[model samples]
Target chain A: MHVTSSVRPPLITGGKTYADVTEDICRQVEGKPTKEWKIAFTISVIVLAYGTACLFWTWWEGLGVWGLNKTVGWAWDITNFVWWVGIGHAGTLISAILLLFRQKWRTSINRAAEAMTIFAVLCAASFILMHMGRPWLAYWALPLPNAFGSLWVNFNSPLVWDVFAISTYFSVSLVFWYIGLIPDLATIRDRAQNKVSRYIYGTLAMGWNGSAKTWARYEYISLILAGLSTPLVLSVHTIVSMDFATSVIPGWHTTIFPPYFVAGAIFSGFAMVQNLMLITRVVYRLEDYITLEHIESMNKVITLTGSIVGVAYLTEFFIAWYSGVEYESYAFINRATGPYWWAYWTMMTCNVISPQLFWSRSIRRSVTWTFFISVIVNIGMWFERFVIIVTSLHRDYLPSSWAMFSPTMYDIGDYIFSFGFFFTLFLLFSKYLPVINMAEVKSVIRSSSEKLPAKVAGVAKGERVANPTFNKDAE
Target chain B: MADLHGKYLVGVYDDDEVILHAISKIRKAGVKISEVYSPFAIHGMDEALGHSRTRIGIAAFMFGVTGCICALCLTIWTMGIDWPMIVGGKDPISIPNYIPVTFELTVLFTAFGMVGTFLVTNNLGPGVNPNMFDPRSTDNKFVMAIELGKNKLTEEQISQVLKDSGAEEVNIKQF
Candidate 1:
């Protein structure tokens, strides 16, 4: 009954079986940390320690420690916030959007990507807290009955919408992720060799027994969650874009921001996913699961979204010029020819130009080239935010108040802090949890695995021979 | 963990296809199946086992409606009725601005509510131990359990039917 196109290359290689899938994925969770993992973990912890200290001082010394002036009140903090939030989008896109589209290749990478999403969103939220100078009064952003008066939060404000959007996104994604993890957790629980691991994984598994009734419900809920999440993901970035779009600033106010920002978010998010997954694939020896075909497929997405982002940039400039508003025209011209031209050009080259290289099949399939481009894409994305936020604000209508913004050490340190925090959380997750979704992978192995030879494939022809490897010694 | 106190015949299957076929053959032989468990969800196995489609979708839709109504009530009550201050000179009750929050709350409620209902219905929660017929059911095996008392066939007859229908191993489970 499980039919697949013979022309399509195998998603899972090495002719693996059900037992092998469990063994291969579970070994990483059950085994001791490899030397490479120890080294990587130690480095992450060191970076986190330094970042925490810098973050502490930033909180202690206050906003003056950053390079924020009246002209550029929102520099590195908002840029980092947007950047991290954009990175979080890829996880939801892969898990929810791809699920709806029936993209089977997503099974190999969705677990780790969703984890990345959660951690990235956490990092993004940290920036919002950090930007609020008086972090203690953060709860005032919420709609609460105030003691001062009967006043409530302004429901019309985009910032309040952000508060709702981000919190809802975080909580819903967490639930979706945990729901997906239950069956795989049960697998780990059943295979645990020690009492501690057994007890721990047991509680986390929530007593999943893989009954037909439970699986039926599980699939149903997963589909509904995916349906809910598609629009949720789009709305998150749309609301983020509205934060600037609703403003009256020359460059900030644009009708195209919602779609443009969403495209750019997915573009940057995929780049981040590629970076993390490539490193993870190598470190965990997961080449069989995260195959080259998977890498190539991701590259194709990168090219498509990157092209869309590129088109948006061109359209923004075209609309700015065609609208004939002197302020908006000046903003676009200044972005290309102003004091911040270096940042603008960097954004163009990195975001608009670099991902186009993925058009070549050889380069798309090359691990070295992909990793190098992914890093470049991330740098470009960060610069894109900087150009949009800083350039638009630096030269206000009044020439007397115009000033250039430059980051102090504290600004740089805070950005580093998010990086440190993200990696540290990611490393811990990789070490402790099953990076690959075991049960989901087992299900797909029947239709997408490498075909077995006739000698090893004991089943009759025309019946589904799901990568049968009856001769275990052949491996 | 609920103590299982029944005698049952458990047939272990190595492949999902074999188990799926076995469900119909064993049912045709007049033996009622108690449950079938597997490492992964076997497509069509639910229908083969004669289970009707789940109603979780209806529950999710209801939760979503509740969320939409709640969001509308919160916005209308706070922004329109309660001491409304006109900041940008727009109307005190702005439905356009309300769309984002309304949409967000709807999704939030639907996701959490449906998941909560799923957990409660499936009898799943943290620290709740499940009655696993075979531990390997979470690994690679497909296990079919039948309460011996409920079935009309003898143990030997049922075991023969299971073997003929492609069960690799047959065992007695006392819960």
Candidate 2:
């Protein structure tokens, strides 16, 4: 059944020691890159250079240089924004939310996912700034109140709301991620082989030592932050959804957006995780740490969220049809049967149908097959945004306002450049930072003993339980 | 250094089931466990550990309420008191009209307030680093710690107590 390989830590029958896990992860940094890394890095650099040149050109010109007319004011810019933001959501979801839920399986991939979130958000913000026609005047989006005195900025605009939400999310996620990195950085510092490595690692470590007392407060604060970050993570996407929901656009103004967008964000985020993890596990031979069981768990989330998004899709259609507003009805109908029907169906097949395969045990566990499906999930999400944005806007209230829209090479270039920006940061993370949470992995190993008596009071298997130990010696 | 001897308590378990079991035994033994240590997060440990429902939600409620109030004040001051511009055929302070701004204020203030509250409650900011123990505590281990008061035994007695309670390794710290 290949179930054994799926359980991973391959032959963890005796359970892997903490030292083994640390040694396994540290091997990548301690050794030279495999042949594949050299090739991949070279390609990424070239692509990154292309992306930089595109950005320079975009800045030299104006947002009008792209194909965005007044009809499709957002075009690839907002699509890329939402896409990258969606990509970033999985980071805090995996690290912060999963930590709050006490999901043991999350430890394997949370570090990498959080790194991806930071990079993806950076990419997303680049789009936002670049899309600002007058990039120098982008501060108008902030709440500084126009200096030229064109009346104080409305406090109610979702566009302004997006500024706070995205910025807060970026900062909070960065803090959450860095706090988790402290001990692992110390681990690298302690074990570093060279003077330069030691100096760099030490600075990042911020003088951490393994004392039991400090750990007490650290644990308390982490729990609190996890609590804080869970809602914050949820809020980031909810606010992002409001960016569309508050708008009077035919397809955008729906109550279903918050939950639907949240689900889709997670769905796409996990898909990206799968994409990166699959290649990483294969290339770095970290299948032991990033196991098939972990993939299955993530696939389960992807599938569940995908199904929720599917319901949202159908619900929007149903609501629009039932509302009997011709414009609204036209939006859905045009999406499904119009010239861009290919985009809509592609969204459905990739995001909705591809994930449904996880309903089967076999499909979810097959590493190779899951990787293929993850690509489909990514493509589906990107197309879904395109369908939602372009289809609804191409034709508005009157037939006289209708016009067909197609992305020019400029549009395509800007979209592709986001990938360049995303990967460049990602490659840097892979090269420098500890991609896995080493401390957490060690703790997992320490607590994996089977000899202890079974069945304590009310502690569930694999769930986050509070600490329960009293000192009789004190009493 | 501080003198907090023999007061700290911890129960160690190898697996989740044992963690739950040890929790039961420890509770039954009338020994208030300062902490429970495990390799992974076992479910329901918070209830087992005697932790209160954290005030984070309450703080969020307060933050959200503050936002609503701020929105009200800002609208009253800016639109009602200041030069009222009747641009959209509506009163500035009207409920229907004020909703969008109110909502935005609610989000903005709640988000910022929650962040500030969180930072303060956690005792986090620049130049204030908390002491650390077992660098591994936040990593892979699920631990519950309780620092003891004045009454306590010798390190050997405490060590024996922890070892009997299934602690894999029992140690002491005087701070």
Candidate 3:
């Protein structure tokens, strides 16, 4: 409602009506796939198949199939885990955080972002499963009664906390996404051309009829869910950061890691969202719904959070020098000047230096530049996690144990496998589900319904005596 | 048609404002309204129709409190009473470390509980058939229905009331 003239660009560009909103969104679901979609889907499947084979090979031969040595035991595995987890943050931030703030623009993008969250979390969970050499025994991580001398899972460890956080995060996000989808699914259900499609949409819709009573309850539930997910978006990452913060490792023990990791997570998350939205907008030909203004607003968030992450980077360096602990100072120095200095410099440039370009209004608004920088920012964030995990562990207190960590073919293969998995799921989602939320987008339109002043005039002059301005029904 | 419940006169409106205006007009004439439908949520239509504010938030709060209590009890029972093991030189009954999982379960239960309450209250589930007043009610049109059996008004009076209230089309629907 607070409309700044310049910042308040019309979210839907083409003056779409309620019917147009439904048609544009439901078309992708009901219609045949384009040539572009076929090509992308094929490539994604191929990559996915190759990645799955690599993962099985690692599992078949043991963790040694990857180049992981004793010193860098968590090199690419945890880096991919954190990277995927960070990418998932953008979805909840958009759906839950922005919803509470009443940013109406989020309606256009939240659906796809929520789907991305589910897939990214799936990818993140896979890394944990793969890292456990005998994944069948991964149930030991849960707080279940084990046969090993009644040894219960440790309640004080961050790893155990992660199990609860990630699982709850997944189920809650899934429910929230499904609840939001109901009404839109009803719209699709009503418009389905065939019996099979109709039944499928009907089951998904769960008997939504758009009754006033149901809408009232639905709106209330949505607000409360958004309220619930806000703290969740923050807590999941804070627990993840605790994976390092609670440790005794020199580079990982800083108090700044919680908020710092959170900021970096959001920065990278938005970058990934931008990357996906750029491709989605093009492939789906949804420029009108996903306007340039949406891109610019997301860029503005990146500029702010990116700057916060940049400051956190500098703050870590200052604290390292200020504390003057030999091990801690050496850890920071080793990150910048040691064998893995390239990874550190990569993080600095991508996470800090590159995103600052958004300070220019022109670059932030340009689709190509935003896309390019988003990719770079994610790369930089991946290296940040890599630098923190590998460099710190590769060199410890004993100089005799000093070593360098490098990823093997299997390591590289597994990461690409995630991309394949992510895109394949995403492509399927885009084809089946309503990409844009029809109900929410309709709420944002200026016209609530069709203007029929001429029809209202047909009710006779006597009816107007009761309500004089009945003809001003343009809204 | 054999399983139809009753005869209801349905009035269609192009705009939400018109429907709001029509509801008051029809109800003021001593006609009982059965239901109203719209494509999207109108801002104050529920209040105008005299429905009470939903108590879902209260349910969410109570569920959240339950989650908090359960989480604390689970952590205590598992770590302190069941089997105590020192971790990272910290106490087995450390409450600070218990906060993360506790907070997570609190949110998780609250969210699931609230959604469950909503679904049950609405009589909705996977295979249940919905009552549809009109297909276009989920699209662009708004509809208000007055069941003849619920009100003592004659067919002529109800039709007249709908027209006087500026209904675009009035139809006799059996569902």
TM-score of each predicted structure versus truth:
0.96, 0.77, 0.94
TM-score on 0 to 1 scale for chain A of candidate 2: 0.91
TM-score of chain B of each: 0.95, 0.75, 0.92
RMSD of each: 3.8, 6.6, 4.0
Model-by-model lDDT, in order?
0.89, 0.69, 0.85
TM-score of 3: 0.94
Off by over 4 Å in 3: A1-7, A148-150, A447-475, B1-5
Q: TM-score (0 to 1) for chain A, all models?
A: 0.95, 0.91, 0.93
For candidate 1, please provide the TM-score of chain A on its own.
Answer: 0.95
Report the poorest 10 consecutive residues by lDDT, candidate 3 chain B. B1-10
Docking class of 3: medium
lDDT winner among the candidates? 1
**Better candidate by TM-score, 1 or 2:** 1
lDDT of 3 by residue, B44-123 (tens): 77767888899988999999999999999888888978887787778889999899989999999999999999999987
The single-chain TM-score for chain B of candidate 2 is 0.75
Residue pairs with colliding backbones in model 1 are B4-B175, B5-B175
Note the DockQ of each predicted structure: 0.59, 0.12, 0.60
